[model samples]
Target: MPPRTIGEEFTKGLWHENPIFRQLLGMCPTLAVTNAVINGIAMGLATTFVLIFSSIVVSSIKKLIPNQVRIASYIVVIATFVTMADRFLAAFFPLISKDLGPYVPLIVVNCIILGRQEAFSSKNSVGRSFIDALGMSAGFILALLILSSIREILGAGTFLGHQFLGSWFEPWVIMILPPGAFITLGILIALTFVIEHKIKQRR
Candidate 1:
């Protein structure tokens, strides 16, 4: 592998280090709200906001926090952002917020967000941390979008509440169920590995 440039850091999470397919972090919301496209998108954006801001803040204040208490400090920072995001969504997007349920509050403990803070942000410069956050958030959102699109279209025969399939097409009730979430995610993960392997072979 070549030495990584700053650009690589920002772009790798799109596929190479995707939080869902690669790292397999934050499975709670990934599986819980992905029954519908709108719910998935709402959860993704809310998580993105929390992840980015928390990374920025954690990186900026890393030095000031003691090693023993760094994890606690990081949680506080993450929780603050999560609270803000939760309230913001509730205020403006009540319907989506309701649909998302407790998953939004659960972002404070999401492994993807806290993992980056502990592994990257706590040691890196603010700029690098921000880029990492951006990449991770983008990857997360993309994963949610793809998963939700597959689920909603097949399960409900709709895309964001708009019917896409003709009357001839019957909805797959299983696609909207828990088993469907696992099955879809499993297939996507396998497909991701195959693509990555092919790319590696090409190189």
Candidate 2:
């Protein structure tokens, strides 16, 4: 295999290999906290912090870890950043922290973060790992934003808590529910597949 350019590394996660839309990783937080835009953003940022730092640490120390314990070691590294992110949110952004609840701490087990550490970061250079993590983070955040925005707007007729629709518009109460998450995610995933197919056909 040839070396990947930085642009290729970064852009892949945005679309080609997006964590949610394409890869379908991290569905727990993706579905749970995305009823509101703010919650989605908070989750996205927390996951980003954990993923980036964990990737860098794992990439930097991959050689020292034994294969048998690499998964455990990666968890510890991911948990450390997860703790910091959780603490920071709890200390300052208490409201959002409360809203996110356990999902923030559960970042320790997020497949996207752990998968990158094991698959990409462990074998790649620090710079490449960072880029991969960043791209993946961007993808995750983008997914959350899209899901939350659709949910929030359709469910509450608002964006980021501000009303977008007037009195005539009735919010779909179901959009904020669990079924809504599934429905919205399903549609988005289908759209992504169609878009990718079109792009492929064009080529």
Which candidate wins on TM-score?
2
Global Cα lDDT for candidate 2: 0.95
Clash count, candidate 1: 0
Best by lDDT: 2
List model 2 lDDT by residue over 1-203, tens digit each.
89879999999999999999999999999999999999999999999999999999999999999999999999999999999999999999999999999999999988999999988999999999999999999999999999999999999999999988997989999999999999999999999999999999999
List where candidate 1 sits over 4 angstroms from the true fold: 1-3
Q: Could you tell me which residue pairs clash in candidate 2?
A: none
Model 1 poorest 10 in a row by lDDT: 1-10
Q: Write the per-residue lDDT of candidate 1 for residues 65-174, one digit (tens) a residue.
A: 99999999999999999999999999999998888889989998899999999999999999999999999999999999999999999999999999999989999999
Determine the C-alpha RMSD for candidate 2 after optimal superposition of all C-alphas: 0.7
